[model samples]
Target: MPTLHELPGLAGQRLGPTQWREMTQERVNAFADVTEDHNYIHVDPERAKASPFGRTIAHGYLGVALLAPISQQLLAVEDATGVNYGMDRLRFPAPLPVGERFRGTAEVAEVTEIKGGMQVKVTLEIEVDGQERPALVADCLFRYYA
Candidate 1:
């Protein structure tokens, strides 16, 4: 956990990469069940192969699902509770084909002290293996307080 003070200032910024496990069929199916985004490109493996992407693509929301886990590792937020305020700009430049690995990098774009809390905006870029473009990119805001 990261101390609250450690976060008041720009904690750190860099291009970080993670080698993810392959996006499995089971996982995609599970996400579909939970979100009700049963897009054929994400579940119909046989049919997906005939599409341009050549494989069932993972849901765009799955990329968002990784935010908390990755952010926890990236920021030290031990003493304070942070709220996921929301997103600003969001874009998915590439498809996340099933069985592919991807990772995210974040840059702290804005930080401010408001009331008794701190508001931070982090720009995130998610990329998949073998893809030159990013799968997801956005300005995600979070607020931490006493």
Candidate 2:
């Protein structure tokens, strides 16, 4: 974690290609149950095997939702609390096939002072193991307050 005073200087710094995590079928199913998005492409391997992807894939939003935990591994401000502000932009460039390993990498794009806090824009990418393209890319904003 960086101190509040040091935060401003972190712009353009690259954070981790975090430890790899698998996108399991059970996790996909759980997300499907919670979001009520049981699209066969996400939850049904047999059916999805017939689709172009040739196997079940994770819902795009599931990767979006994973950003929270993934970001934790990349950033935190010392002696301050942070909250998600929003995303400036988001794109799923490639599907995250189920059972594949993925990890996050982040670059601190910009940091600015806010009225009672600081705001940072971090460009985050989730990459799938063995895939050339990333599963998701986002310019995510966050606010930190002491």
| Top of the candidates by lDDT | 2
User: Mind giving the per-residue lDDT tens digits that candidate 2 earns over 56-75?
Assistant: 99999999899998888889
Best by TM-score: 2
Cα lDDT over the full model 2: 0.94
RMSD (CA, Å), each prediction: 1.9, 0.7
Give the runs in model 1 whose Cα sits over 4 Å from its true position. none
- In Å, residue 9's CA in model 1 sits off its true spot by 2.9
Error of 2 at 90 (Å): 0.6
lDDT for 9 in candidate 1 is 63
- Model 2 TM-score relative to the real fold: 0.98
On residues 41-97, what C-alpha lDDT tens digit does candidate 1 reach at each position? 999999888888888998988878877666655654777888788999888889888
Candidate 2 pairs with clashing backbones: none
